[model samples]
Target: MESRQRALVLHRLPYRETSLLLDLFTEQQGRIRLVALGARRRRSTLQGCLQVFTPLQIQWRGTGGTLQTLRQAEALSLSLPLTGRALYSALYINELLCRLLVPDVSYEALFGQYLQTLCQLAASDGQYEPILRCFEFALLQALGYGVDFQRCAATGTLVQDQVHYRYQAEYGFVTAAVASQDSFSGQQLRALAAGQLSDAATLRAAKIFSRLAFKPYLGARPLKSRELFY
Candidate 1:
């Protein structure tokens, strides 16, 4: 049977001197690998459509294994004009999905969310850290690894604005008597929980909290795209 769906180009690599191997994220089928034969030819029609962050309508039929051969790819939307920092952040989004998401499962909602994240990146300047933070938190939540910033895990009490707390990697936030580098104020945590990252303090703490929560799932290998930030 043939399958056709809207897809986002995640990653692409040269194949066999002429073809291109693509990692694509589909709306209904999740991540799939497909090879576009002769895609490197000077007159290839797939050239413009097969790019990272470009929305495409892809058609293919599966072989026996995990890979497939691309029959056709059509552009569904215009290219997102992301450059500089925003481009790197967009790539980071791709890296996260490629690393953490389970293959062959339908991540329909996450697919939409991913596209929205890219749009947000394209529209913002250098101040999109909060947008990325929110997307990261949302992605973690979608994957069932989300950390609760609303309540203290140890005491089960509502987080208060005046208190200081520390985020344990395995558990949720706990009130900290002695603040450390990783310790976050209760107000900041609450603001993060509310997705309010306009303030510098909350934005910084949100990044720290998100990075800590994501560290385990992403494994020890650092994301290569993060180097583009520096």
Candidate 2:
């Protein structure tokens, strides 16, 4: 049976001579690996459409295999021109999806969020933090490791803005008797939950939360794209 899906090109590598191996985040199929035969050739139309951060319509026919053969791919839009920090941020996004997402399982909501993140990165406005934090939050939720910034895991109550809360990597946020390295102000927590990145402190707290939230899945090595920012 033939499978047609809309996908975001995550990563692609040269396979043999003229062919390419692709990692795509698809709405219907999640993270899929497809072999694009002859895609690297000069005359192949897919060579232009197969680039990163471009919306693509892909058709493939396969099941019960580690890889699928791409039947066709059409570019729905032009490639996004993300430069400077935005480009690095976009690369980080791709790396995260490729590293964490389970193959062949559909995550439609995550896919939508990924597309939205790409759009924000393409803006070239240099406001990468807020968008990145939101996407990371959403990604964690979609992957079933959601952070409970708005609620206390122990008390099962709404987090208080005046209180201090400490984040436990295995657990969510809990009320803290004393502020420490892992603790953040409740106001900052609430602000982060609301996607409001107005203050310097809140941004700092969000950055800490991002590290804690992703620490479990990221393994020993640091994210390579993260280094590009500084």
Candidate 3:
């Protein structure tokens, strides 16, 4: 007998002759892959429910070592259809999760953030840059690489309105003078710290800053979805 689990379908691919391999982000078990037997056949029950970016309630049966088989599934909701840039951005988010997150690492907070981001993208008429940046920050924090933007990395003093600062990858932020050659701006840092997303200039700056921050984790492979937007 297999255990039942609630999961978010993160990614899926065709498997075998008529099956599907699903990469799922679950509530209790974190990420796992399951084989959906004969899911491609017409009228197959599992075919319609399993899709990227959708929430799913699923049950699978397998022991400790082998790939599990999906026994039952149901769609939780109708995911908002994202098109054009929004679609690309959604794919970018998925790519980030595929690359950075480790399977079976329980991160309920990060999962919540992911769901929130999708909802934001689905509804907002605003630019997606700010939404993506905010999610990036949240994801990093959940993964234990959160940056400290409240105080100067050099002086350890609380951030002040009149002072400029620079962000470094290894060190969070330092006084402008001490930041040496790092790339960042005091205004942008403050804006992010304050959680203001409506400012376009601040949003652009945050995007650049986050790109630099996430570089190490992304390795040499460029995110293909990014190209669709750029």
lDDT of 2: 0.88
What is the total number of backbone clashes in candidate 1? 0
> Which regions of candidate 3 are displaced past 4 Å?
63-66, 160-164, 176-182
- For model 1, the stretches where C-alpha displacement exceeds 4 angstroms are 63-65
Predicted candidate 2 versus true structure: per-residue lDDT over 119-185, tens digit per residue: 9888747778888988988989988998777899899899888899988887988989998877998
Candidate 1 residue pairs in clash (backbone atoms < 3 Å): none
Model 2 pairs in collision = none
Report, for every candidate in turn, its global Cα lDDT versus the true structure.
0.88, 0.88, 0.79
Identify the leading candidate in terms of TM-score. 1
Per-residue C-alpha lDDT of model 1 across residues 1-230, encoded as one tens digit per residue: 68899999899999998899988899998888899999998899998889998889999888435678899999988999999889999999899988987777778888999999899899996788988998898788878888778899999999988888988777889999987778888888888888998988888898889888988888899999999888
| Residue-by-residue lDDT tens digits, candidate 3, 117-218 | 888888878578888988998988877888877778887878876666776776787777643334446666777888786877777767877887888889
Stretches > 4 Å off in candidate 2: none
Cα RMSD (angstroms) for every candidate in the order listed: 1.6, 1.6, 2.4
**Each candidate's TM vs. the true structure?**
0.94, 0.93, 0.88
